[model samples]
Target: MNILQLNFEAGWRGGERQTMLSMLQFREEGHTVHLLCRAGSQIGERARAAGFVVHERKGSGGVIGFLALSGKRYDILHVQTGHMLTWAVLTKLLHRTLVVYSRRVAFRLKGALTRFKYRKTDLVVAISEACANSVQALGIQHVPIIADAVLPVSPNATRSQMLAGQLGIGQRKVVATTSALAADKDPLMLVDAIAALKKRRNDFVFVHFGAGALEPEVRARVAALQLQDTFLFAGYQQNVEALFGLFDVFVMSSREEGLGSSVLDAFSARVPVASTSAGGLKELLADDRGLMSAPGDAGGLARNIGQLLDAPDWLGAMTSKAAEYFERTHRLDTMADAYLVMFEQLLNERRRPRTAAIATAPAATPGIAVESHNQA
Candidate 1:
């Protein structure tokens, strides 16, 4: 199958990582996979470096411009971000190719144009049940759940040691987080949790592995709380996955999340996770897989982190179960295979006679109102 993966994000976030994983897996499975991303984007550069045929556009306008002028078509155009949904729908209208959108956020859909664009897609795959619920609220039915898969990490002891030395993490238990310091991620709450945890114990160092718009506020809180030596902000490393094994525990203080893919990375690395029960995080951390706390509960989050770091036996048991869960449900091949099936199914539907095919317009979901122009 020929596929064109589209992600307009300039940064290398969870969504971009997933997009790269899918392209790699599809190509490995003997399918043609190409990428279309903004010029100089991390994903585009990485894709180009990896020898994939990458089509680079300038920006959102450039994307539409390319679609209008280019005569090439593909078997599938997979939209990997929410902001790119409208362009993907337009491409479908232009080229008659099946558009598959992967909705990775749990934020409620607002605006009539947003709902209309989403409904026009041939398929909308939600990464978690919470995200699926949000999409279904727009009266779009059969939103299949396809959870994000973790790119397997090969432990690099040499790299870990070098990073540890650089970060002054000698013999200190590392409490790490890979969440972007943003509003949804609640970096302020994390700083408060770190402060609360510090009063009880000062042996661990909190190393954050992301950068975002709220960096200044988070930095101010860390300084005000006098966590200068304790809280370390290691902004957005390209191969941050390699450092997960160095962490004793991984904490995510997200106010909302789709599925917390970083938690899956922690599980793969045998690092015990302490995260809030935000959105699909509840589903991932259920069955004693990890320590869970209510969103915004800094005290509870701190306590959970303490337990994970202090109780080695319980941590081992939880990590063992979490690793098993990751192995079973979050493998890269499993997710790639599901996408292949979805692609083939959509292709078959498109090949059917016009009269036999069903309409793509979303059906009205009784009692579930779509709030137009209401931004969440």
Candidate 2:
């Protein structure tokens, strides 16, 4: 299959990571995969490094039009970002290309334009059941829940030791979190939890990875709370999996989340997780694999962390269960296979015969009268 993957995001986040994984898997399976991403974006650079054909564009506007006008057809046009989804809709309207939109966020589609775009997509791939449910709640049907893949983490003890030494956390229990330091991530709540944990036990240190717009604010709160020594902001590291070896426990303090891919990473590393039950996190961290607290509740989070830390045997059991669950359900190959199946089903549906009058009908306003065929 000739697949054109579009991700206009400049940064390499979870969505971009999933796109890369899908492209790599498709290529390995002898499918022709092409990437269209923002010029000089980390995703573009990495895709090129991985030997995939990458088309760099300044924006999604003219490039998508150019592709449609140039008569370069793709079997599937998979859009991985919201901006790209608009372009995909345009391309579909002009060329009837099979467009698939991956909905990774749990936000509802509020406006007519957003709803119209989703309705026109050949398939909607939601990264979690919560995301799919949110789409359904918005009255957009035909959404399928395809959870994001988590690559296996090969522990590097030397790298972990080096990271520990650099952070000055010798022999200290490390409660690590990898997330963008933003309001949605609730880094301040994490600082509050760290403060609460410190009052009870000072043997542990908190290390946060990743940078974002709220870094200054998070830093101010950390400093104001006098947690400079206890809380270490490691900034953004490219190879995050290597550092997972250093974590005795992983925490996700997001006020809102999609599926919490970092929690999946923690599972891959066989580390116990403590996360806010935000969005699809409740789906991933079930069955005693992790402890959960309500979003933005620092006290609740602190209590959960303290309880987990106090029980080493329970932590070990959760870690084992999490690893087993991740292996069974969230492997990279399994996710890729599921996507391939969806792609095939969409392509087959497109090939079915339709009455000329029905086929030529104008795109209707979504969530009104039109019924979608691929609803779960």
Candidate 3:
């Protein structure tokens, strides 16, 4: 199969990581995959380094250029971000290629433009059930839930020791989280939780492994709360799985999340998770795999973390369960196989004369409430 993946994000967030994983897996399965990403972006650079054919372009205009140049060469166009959804819709109108969108956020599609773009998509793959529900509510009946996968890593004790020395977290229990310090991530709430946890115990240190617009604000709050000693904004680290293996516990304080792939990374590393019950996190942390708290509640987050810290036996049980869950459901090959199956089904359906009605339909417009159930 020939595939063209579109992602306009300039940062290396969870979505970008998943995009890379899918592209690499497809290539490994003897499929030709190409990535169209922002010029000089981390995803583009990484994809190129991984020996994939990468087209680096600027914005929606770049997307148009790519489609005009080589869009017809691919069988499928997989769009991985919202910024590129409109471009994908336009491409679908211009080509026979099936346009598949992966919805990574749980935000509702309210705008007419947003709804129209999604309605015209051939398939909408939600990264979590919460995200699928949100998409279905917007009248897109073809939404399917395909959870993201994480690559398991062996614990790198040497790297952990080096990181500990560099961060000055010697002999301290590490409570780590990997998230962009943004409003949605609620980094301030994490800081507050760390502050509250400090009041009870000072033996643990909080480490964050991401950067965002809210970095300065988070740092200022950490200082204001006198948590400079307890909190270490380790910035963005590429080998997060290695760091997860070193962590005593992984905490997620996001106000909203699609599925919390970082939590999956923690599970892959056999670390217990303490996260806010935001979006699909509730689903991932189910069955006593981890402890959860309400979103934006620092007190609850602290209490959950305390439960893990105060009980080693309970933590071991949770980590063991998480590891089992990861082994069962989060394998890279399993995710790749599921996607390939969906791709084959869509392609086979497209080959049917009866399904050609989708191509004969009127072009989607901003105001038209296209009832996608016809194609669904």
Any runs in candidate 1 off by more than 4 Å, and if so which?
Answer: 354-376
**Whole-model lDDT for model 1 versus the true structure?**
0.88
**Please, what are the lDDT tens digits per residue for candidate 2 over residues 231-277?**
99998899788889888778999877889888889998988888899
What is the C-alpha lDDT profile of model 1 across 1-376, one tens digit per residue? Answer: 7788989999888999999999999999988888888889999999999989999988778887666555145788888987677887776556666789999999888998898898788899999999999999999889999999997666778888898999998888999999888899999999999999999998999999999999999999999999999999888887899887788889999999999999999989888999999999998999999999999999999999999989766678888899999999999999999999999888766555542433454675689654221111
Per-prediction TM-score: 0.92, 0.92, 0.92
lDDT of 1 at 152: 68
On a 0 to 1 TM-score scale, where does candidate 1 land against the true structure? 0.92
Candidate number with the higher lDDT (2 or 3): 3
Clashing pairs in 2: none
Best by lDDT: 1
C-alpha RMSD between model 2 and the true structure? 6.6
Which residues of candidate 3, in runs, are more than 4 Å off?
Answer: 354-376
Candidate-wise lDDT, in order:
0.88, 0.85, 0.86
Q: List pairs with backbone clashes in candidate 3.
A: none
